[model samples]
Target: MTVTHALEGDVLRRQDPELADLLLGERERQASTLQLIAAENFTSPAVLAALGSPLANKYAEGYPGARHHGGCEIADVAERLAVERAKALFGAEHANVQAHSGSSAVLAAYAALLRPGDTVLALGLPYGGHLTHGSPANFSGRWFDFVGYGVDAESGLIDHDQVRTLARTRRPKAIVCGSIAYPRHIDYAFFREVADEVGAYLIADAAHPIGLVAGGAAPSPVPYADVVCATTHKVLRGPRGGMILCGAELAERVDRAVFPFTQGGAQMHTIAAKAVAFGEAATEAFAVYTHQVVANARALAAALAAEGLVVTTGGTDTHLITADPAPLGVDGRTARGRLAAAGLVMDCCALPHADLRGLRLGTAAVTTQGMREAEMIRIAAFIGQALRDEASAPRVREQVRDLAGAFPP
Candidate 1:
């Protein structure tokens, strides 16, 4: 059976009906709605099986064949496969597949390259960047002095010249490039050039778009950046985990930072699932999926525009589209709520340089379900219709259910 087909089988219904009810309800929700959250995706049954395996019961605290504990032979095998697969999939000289989550991986990368109070240049959180980039609440911001640069006013894209100026003046120890809500292609090469001039390490956080990079559908930072961090899930459609890829020259420091500095004990089951995801991503089928993801996003952005919504950057170059309906005078939160009621799931994102909010929609999950341009247009109509009349949400929800049913995950 296909990996996805196996996930449809039964699990834990008899032992704990309450938990099973919650689990199954989520399955129903996923199968019934248009999931557009940018950083989410549906994992295959093989990944699910790995997550539920006995490998989770062990404690493997070090690298393969050199763990601090006993009975780690199988753990070593799983981790080795994950590590090798990540390296092969991304064309990196070294890979660390044991970070518990993407945020932890970011922290580890920082620890690997910088000491406390070291200065860094990164994109701002209020803009299209991550909290770990330089949010005052996050550890990276607390421990490091991070100068944040944002998108240009009219273009709604990163200002390379501004970044270059900051790198020259700040003289940061490291520079971070990547985002959580950006809707355009990142200029990683330019970031690298700035870093080189400043004698700084360049780190690219490709957590949201790594799948596209892995499938060769997006430009990769592997050859340009000093270190790269990514999540195994999201567009990659693996288990929820984190990974680090870097050159062999930086591998030893990266690995040591991940193990003894940032985290301890590998999640081997999740790593096994990551191995499956990497294998799947390296195939032709996965390449086709990422291509569809980008196409569908562009299509959806155009459709949303057709309905009078303002698409940021005039559209998207990746799988995500950020649209603001505030011009229609509707509160962004209320519009998002209406969309949710209409069986469309997405998040209200912060619009840079404005007091307004916007919706950050993605096509990764829908593309995974074999959706294309036509489906994107229909979904956009549902969004516009729902925003116009909340009373029409119930009817639109049924239409959403019908469309969702036609394409099972």
Candidate 2:
């Protein structure tokens, strides 16, 4: 039997019957929905197998060669392989694969570099930044004094001038760059220059673009920033996990921050899955996949714009596109719900300068499922119809079902 078939068989045999039913249901749901979540993707069968492997039974509380628990030789090898693969893939001097999620990785980075009440400069939340960058409700905001910069109102793109002004005035201990919704390519070199001028460490949160970066579809911050953090699941198509990569000078500090300070006992299973993902990412197929992701996004953006929707930044240079749905006589929330009913899954986005009328669409999930420009065209047509009339939704839903049937998840 094939790997996927074997995995399904194993799940059927070992898991509780109720749980097995739930798993089957979820698989059916994925098979039927057009998942457009920018921050999500489907992992390879190898990566999934590693995540569900017996390695989950082990407990390695510390870094390799210095574990607090015994019977950790295999765990150590798994983690070491993960770290080495990450370092090679990203060309970083060091890698920490212990973070449970992207937010955890950010916390570890903060814990390693800053004390309580340090000033941090980050992108404003509504301007495409993550809450962990400095939302008032999150630890980063609560513990550190955070000042934010926004994109230009006219161009809807990051203003280096504004960033320079903020850096000079705020003088934060760290300057963060990267976003979950911004469609254009990030100017990591510009961020580095600004951070240096203010004597602040540069932290690039490339969680959204990790896959593109790995496949050379986008610029990598590893060569320019003091530290970089990313989720393994997004573009990377790994298990739900996070990693931190940095220069060798800060390696020990980052490792300690992740272990004793932020979390205890590494998730060895997730780490092994990440190793599988890194190995897959190093292949020629992954590079082609990344290229197709960007191409698909651009195609979708063009199709939506042609249908009279307002695409943010005029276009996209990456796998995500944000569009204002007000011209289509609908708001973001309404569009999100309607799309779900139509089997096209996307997200509502809020811009710092505008109200929450924009919808965010990503190509990562669909591209991983082997979608191309023709599929994007059909998907865009369905979205356009769905937003045009609440009454026309049933027909649009049928179209979605047809397209989803053509491409099984």
Scored against the true structure, residue 165 in model 2 reaches a CA lDDT of 93
Tally clashes: model 1.
0
TM per prediction: 0.97, 0.97
User: What RMSD, rounded to one decimal, does every model reach?
Assistant: 1.7, 1.7
Residues 190-285 of candidate 1: C-alpha lDDT, one tens digit per residue: 998999999999999999989999887899999999999999998999999899999999999999999999888888888989999999999999
User: For candidate 2, what is the total of clashing residue pairs?
Assistant: 0
Q: Which candidate number maximizes lDDT?
A: 1
> Residue 52's C-alpha lDDT in candidate 2?
79
The positional error of residue 362 in candidate 2, measured at the CA in angstroms, is 0.5
* Residue pairs with backbone overlap in model 1: none
